[model samples]
Target: MASLNVGGLGGYLREQRRTAQLSLRQLADAAGVSNPYLSQIERGLRKPSAEILQQIAKALRISAETLYVQAGILDERDRGEVETRGVILADPTLDERQKQVLLQIYESFRKGNGYGADDGPAGEGGTSSAGTADAS
Candidate 1:
């Protein structure tokens, strides 16, 4: 298990809150936390409980698991998947819909092929022909 990354988690939360166009007080009200407490959280001065994280995630319209992973509260089972997602999201050339589509396709392929962080394409007796083609 990884140690808690308070700074990373706080930065993530602050980014999400800003992206949502919400004021500190507004998010605090939505998450049922005091504004000063939320400010402390965003400043990396406090560690929020899982419940508070969930509430904030809900207010931000994001997945609680994302916050949990950022906080290192949960062990990420698929680091590759997360990395792929980060790359896609960080691409400036892709719009939101494009990013979503790409992520959907990537996840579908991974799921259909049983690929995971620890499992290569040819996992469990399966053969990957991704880079191979027959010349007729």
Candidate 2:
């Protein structure tokens, strides 16, 4: 079955923040939240309500709807397929290569004819799908 990680949204946000090189205080200021609270959320020690999530999303310049879906606050349209993949790939335990692998599989699965069953096999049955593979 397709799965999602409810905890991933926080980590993803944290990564984005870091990529933007914004300090917690700066992000919090931009998002209009307390630094401590934003820190807690980044560390996965706290969860934000939808309204707060929207604010954070705005600060991150991403869609709140996308954040909700990643946070597991919203169900994925493809029977949780997208959410599930995001959760797994978002895991902090994964290295960059692993994350890339997961993303490849997810993209292939998403575009495949059958998601799970009649669905076509993952790109290489265990390999990352670089370009050139039929998305179908």
Candidate number achieving the greatest TM-score relative to the actual structure: 1
Write candidate 1's Cα lDDT for 1-120 as tens digits: 568888899999999999999999999999999999999999999989889998999999987778989888865655457667888999999999999888767766664565543344
TM-score of 1: 0.57
TM-score per candidate, chains pooled:
0.57, 0.52
Q: How many angstroms is residue 91 displaced in model 2 relative to the true structure, after the best TM-score fit?
A: 36
Summarize candidate 2's per-residue lDDT along 1-136 as a digit string, tens digits: 2333536877898888988888889999999999999988887778788899989888988767687777776655543565566678779999989887777766666554333422333453433333444553
> Which regions of candidate 1 fall more than 4 Å away from where they truly are?
78-136
56, model 1: CA deviation in Å? 0.3
- Candidate 1, position 89, lDDT: 100
| Candidate 2 weakest ten by summed lDDT | 112-121
